[model samples]
Target: MSALIPALERQPDKPALCFGDVVLSYAQLAGAAYALAGKLAGRGRVAVWATPTPHTALAVVAGVLAGVPVVPLNPRSGARELAHVLADSTPDVVCVAPETELPEAAAGLTTLTVTLAPPADAAPLARPEPGPDASAALIVYTSGTTGAPKGVVLSRRAVAATLDDVAEAWQWTGDDVLVHALPLFHVHGLILGVLGPLRRGGTLRHLGRFSVDGVTRALTEQGGTLLFGVPTMYHRLAESAGEDAALARALGGARLLVSGSAALPVYDHERIRSATGARVIERYGMSETLMNTSTRPDGPYRPGTVGVPLPGVDVRLVDDDGERVEADDGETVGEIQVRGPNLFTEYLHRPDATNGAFAGGWFRTGDVATRDADGFYRIVGRKSTDLIKSGGYKIGAGEIENALLEFPGVREAAVTGAPDPDLGERVVAWIVPADDAAPPDEAALTDHVAAQLAPHKRPREVRFVTELPRNDMGKVMKRELR
Candidate 1:
């Protein structure tokens, strides 16, 4: 309504959203949302059971339309985590689909069961004016890796700014149809995947669950132009495309292929490219900042880099002393700090956290990265877990993991620092062998890493595992590894 998502009015009859067999046009989606909005008007804050269904999307739109801040609860969260979020956010009501069975923590809240479609006899309501652009629109919670999850308060201005910036960077337009199977709880899925298409006046087809067949059908048979996914999905496609001819052809036919939420390994990037002739566009951002950088639709699809900053976003790298790391060699890594309109307003009600997040108006992102001479930024790892300090050298765990994946017998790799007497920290690798019967020998893996990277960066010890611990977004939980 604030030009945040002009598609609802601009292309009223065009296909807007699809989940399963139900396809809702812009008119239908808006009508349902407006009807629900009239019911929820003046409600303070609302919690949404963030399922990947049209009902969830409609409820979110309805809450925003009614000028209530929407808080999306992760369906996978445990009771303690759910309790913490409900207590911290203090939502007045919770909206859910008819089929959703919410956990015990949300049982006592005022619940509203959203219908799948609009009622036939209901009269069309007058379009309401939008709320203030500076007002809070969404209160997204962060993963409680270190402590309890904190709600990140994002304004309507920030969300619109990010969507517009990325729209320019990626040549996104109303003619495109976006496809993804990501969860609707987090920024990657809810904000970017669901809201992005609506803002562009484009169509969104959500795969209820990710599968090679579903993605292929959407891209080929359904006129889907853009595909957004996490690395794990791409990895599966790469693995399947070698044998599935239609899947590879469908991937090549798509106008844009995007990967985010975590770094796509260099090996998977190459594999997908070689098989499908699709270059996966990688982007970087977090809950606090919606989107920072994205590889342009124009060119230069680098394997390990996330590309340059988006429009209206200012990015800088700072060393341990907080001085700028002004090298162009792309070897020196530093903590990324950003100043932009796309950043969240504050951590909801946590003044201490909100105050600590910004350094002189630039939000200090704990992610470590390197910048090339041409302004492209390559994320190395997170400073708290993946920056391995061994023998006076600051090593990025990502590069070493890439090196390990390049070796013949490694399926997946995760690197972290372990306490060492001689070195401050020694790089330890947790590996999933390509073949369990013939796991890669420690000596061979060590030699390969020493040759690919530096000797100091090689893993001091390697432990084989069936699989690495991952979060819902498919990010390796390095904190658990340590």
Candidate 2:
């Protein structure tokens, strides 16, 4: 708290954030947070369900400074989901902007309403000094693409570790202006997009919603020096020609560009470089552990790999039989396990799930990967039912699907292992067409794939599907396809 206040004091006149037409300087931001803190006195946990606007950012800072655990609720979440989380967290207070409705169950709890105008004569709340072991934040519910979402618990130290690494790795400074369009509820946007920049006294340009035009304008007009996005966002940017040139010029001044959340296809990597003359650095991380590895700015940029582990992070690959695999040759494949300071302490209210996720103090990532000769790591796929094993050979569905995306008329593809009596399992490909034209013939796709893959790896059957099922974060759910 002291660290943040002094920085805000130094830059009281400098712009701290710009959201749509509203602008807030550091001084105003701090003052609002302090006032909000006064309203949150005696609150155990406060739930924030507002949109990802500048006001939401203020609420988070206020909750943290007040020593109350904050839960960021997704705006699109249904009533049931909201009720489940609110009941579990048992927050003493719920804070939302004017006109927002709270869950019926929340009627018993004290509610603090906020608006664009500052509250009058709001008494400053007594800020509690938290113990080192206390929970500072609660990230509500994973995407739950495969099952019910569970809340992940993180400590102040853990969150700080991630912010520190991001700041150092990205070279953040007071002059840096970040263009943030990612949702604030997710870890990527909340920690990396917002908190990380603020820790360095940098300014953030927040977008309430994502639009290619608005993003292009912000990058060009605001002199945004950093861009953080998922692979889907990059793909959309690559699809627009007019925005492509604008993006290229806007990104020309950026020191770094990062892509995560899901695997980044090789084609997207090459296209981004061709269009912007900037290499998009791929990183590996999850909700359990904020960030583990990144493609270094001073190192060689490997296309398909997630690069080496970050400083103070340890990674090991263990086969199904529980034996460790040496990553030196790049031939070994196993479940990736990590031990780092940024790893979450546990899942909120899920002791059994938490116990099953950790082994000997190391977090089991449930990801399959192998390291190259130079220690660069490439994620093969998920260890769950998502992996496709056909003809007695293990195959990463993402690898084959990504390769198929390179074809001219193939917009997207998904590979799944289908039961086959003869071969135990056979590879099946599902495709989404690029246009109204019928999908390429199965034989033509087979021949096209034959040029790139071995016979055993080729898909034996091809099926065209209308669309692939994805979670809120846009991750394809292979379990449903199987």
Candidate 3:
């Protein structure tokens, strides 16, 4: 209520959100959320079945209105993962849609069904004053690359701060219409894609499922000014743009295109730009820190960089010994560390992890990156998998992956470090070939990388596959490949 209440009050009848054909105006959304909040007033913490639907959005809003922490559960989560999350979070109530079936993992929890539309007697309640800075807002779980997923406890202040910073950076306002087709469980989708527009008093059109036709129609018909997507969605748009002028026209008409969660290949970037004349801006962030850096909406566009730090965010590159690594030259690889109000308070129930995550009050992000002379940041890869030391040289897998994507027959590529007695770590590539019948030979691919980058950076071993393992947000899982 403290954040989006002003928007709801100013534009009561304006359309606030849409999913497929179902639409909810500011007044209607307020009524439904208030009605639900009355029922869930004292619930300590609740879990919602976070799907790309309006009901999920309303449930979260109700929790916010009642000053309750919300935990979003991934709908696609397997039984064990879901069980682990439920056990870890221990939510008082599990919210679901009217006709939604609870997964087996939701057993033994008190369940509540959220109705999308407000009933006749529903009314908007007067919002209270802003809560304290320490009030928990959302408990978002990590991807669990190490072991079990850790629940990142984000405060209301952190969420509001990041959203406001993004609003200023993107020049977002009430007149703009935002379109996205992303799952709602993650920060990119629910926090930015959904709540950002509401905070700006802007309209949101959520394409239920991602499709070129859906994206084109939303951008053109809904007068959408901004679009948010991961690389997979953009890759599909780029592949379809050559044959679909309407899609290109739709993309070109938009004011901004953003890609995140993973690096958008330079190949896809070029393809989309060539077809639509719009460069997709990238951003760098993690679950712990909501958003640290982003490309400005009205600034010079760089294809590979994620632009400079956002307002109120401080970013630095540090070596293994915790000394600062100056990135003025732009080729030195160092781990990214950030200190800002946008950071999460802690990992729920894991005090040791929370303490270890911060170094002298700066959160140590495991992401490796470089900064150019102009202060633009380019993420190389993850420190665990992407940093490869071979032949006494520190190489980033992202640079080589970008180089491989430029070659003729490389569709999707993931580079990882494999143990080698000679090089200490040999660069091994797992590639999804463009064509099975005419796959690029390993020697030719190696030579291609050797030409684009240094010969020492070339992949020592290349394995061709039909597809690479990807997560819900479209990031390639390099740890799995290794």
lDDT of 2: 0.75
Q: How much is the lDDT of residue 295 in candidate 1?
A: 91
Worst 10 residues of 3 by lDDT: 123-132
Residues forming the 10-long window of minimal summed lDDT in candidate 1: 122-131
| Candidate 2, residue 297: lDDT | 75
Q: Could you give me the TM-score of model 2 versus the true structure?
A: 0.93
Return the clash pairs for model 3, or none: none
lDDT of 3: 0.88
**Residue-level lDDT tens digits of model 1 in 1-482:** 53566667667789999997999998888878878877777778899999888888888877777777899999889999999999999999889999677788788898899985776653334555454464688999999887899999988888888989989999999899999999999898888888899888899999989999999999999999999999989989999988899999999899999999889999999988898988899999999999999998796878899999998999999999999999968899999999998999899889999999999999999999999998889899889998888999999999999999989889999999999999989999999999999999999998899998888888999999999999999999988877
lDDT of 2 at 209: 73
TM-score of each: 0.98, 0.93, 0.98
Error of 1 at 472 (Å): 0.3
lDDT of 2 by residue, 247-286 (tens): 6676655777788888888878877777777788888888
Give the whole-model CA lDDT for all candidates, comma-separated: 0.89, 0.75, 0.88
Tell me the deviation in Å of residue 156 in model 1.
0.4
- Residue 165: error of model 1 in Å? 0.7
